[model samples]
Target: MQAYRIDGVVRQGKTNQDFCIDLVAENEDQVREKVYSNFGSRHGAKRRYITINSITTIDPSESSAPVVVSHFRDK
Candidate 1:
């Protein structure tokens, strides 16, 4: 598994909110899909309403997320 930092905006009504999240995935494509699915289910935002600004690969040692930390720690 790889850790990724995804930065983007999610459309909510007339405004867009900035979001930066970390996720574990095999590749960028999977990460992108996860973002859309997550926002869709959690925030009621559609795929078209999400804009991905950047996708950065994060070194395991640099990740502060507990999910990322625990995942790599257990490996």
Candidate 2:
């Protein structure tokens, strides 16, 4: 698996809230599905409301310092 940085925006009410997520996945398609599944379930948002702006693989050297950590994880 590879680490990917997914950037996008989701429609929330009258606003479009931007989000960035870092996760481990195999490819861009998997990244997209994961993003949609995560946002949809966590925020009760529909797939149509989510817009993926960019999907890029993270270099291994930079994975040591991720920009956006998952808040859902236990410390």
Candidate 3:
């Protein structure tokens, strides 16, 4: 798996909020799918409400999320 940084905006009830999240996926397309599923379950957010602006492939050291860091560190 590779570490990715996903930046985007989510609309909920007339409110739009920006979001940045770190995730591990095999590719950018997988990252998008994961993001959509995660947001859907956690926030009751639909795919249409989520706007993914950028999907960046980042080095392990550059990751801010501990889980991502740990996954790479342990490997």
Candidate 4:
């Protein structure tokens, strides 16, 4: 497993809100799917409403701080 940082925006009403999320996944595809599922469940957002700008692998050392982490399970 690898840590990934996904940067994107989600449509909320008439505006788009930026988001930075960190998760443990094997690849970028997994990261994208998790983001869609997570935001959809939490905010009632559809896949079309989410726009992923970038997905990058995160160094484990850089993730040692006290940041909120999200755990995703593959469906």
Pick the winner on TM-score between candidates 2 and 3.
3
Global lDDT of each candidate: 0.93, 0.79, 0.93, 0.80
Predicted candidate 1 versus true structure: per-residue lDDT over 31-50, tens digit per residue: 99999999999999999999
Q: What TM-score does each of the candidates earn?
A: 0.91, 0.79, 0.92, 0.82
Q: List the residue pairs that clash in candidate 4.
A: none
Expressed as tens digits, the lDDT of each residue in 4-67 for candidate 4 is 8888999999999999887777788888888999999999999999999999887755664233
Model 4 local distance difference test score:
0.80
Q: Which candidate is the best by lDDT?
A: 1
* Per-prediction tally of clashes: 0, 0, 0, 0
Instruction: Report the C-alpha lDDT of model 3 over 1-75, residue by residue, as the tens digit.
Output: 899999999998889999999999999999999999999999999999999999998887888798798889866
TM-score of 2: 0.79
Q: Ten residues in a row with the worst lDDT in model 4?
A: 66-75
Worst 10 residues of 3 by lDDT: 66-75
Clashing pairs in 2: none
What C-alpha root-mean-square deviation, in Å, does candidate 1 show against the real structure? Answer: 1.1
Instruction: For residue 20, give model 2's deviation from the true position in Å.
Output: 0.7
Screening candidate 1 with a backbone cut-off below 3 angstroms (N, C-alpha, C), the clashing residue pairs are none
lDDT of 2 at 55: 91
* Stretches of model 3 off by over 4 angstroms after superposition: none
Error of 4 at 2 (Å): 0.3
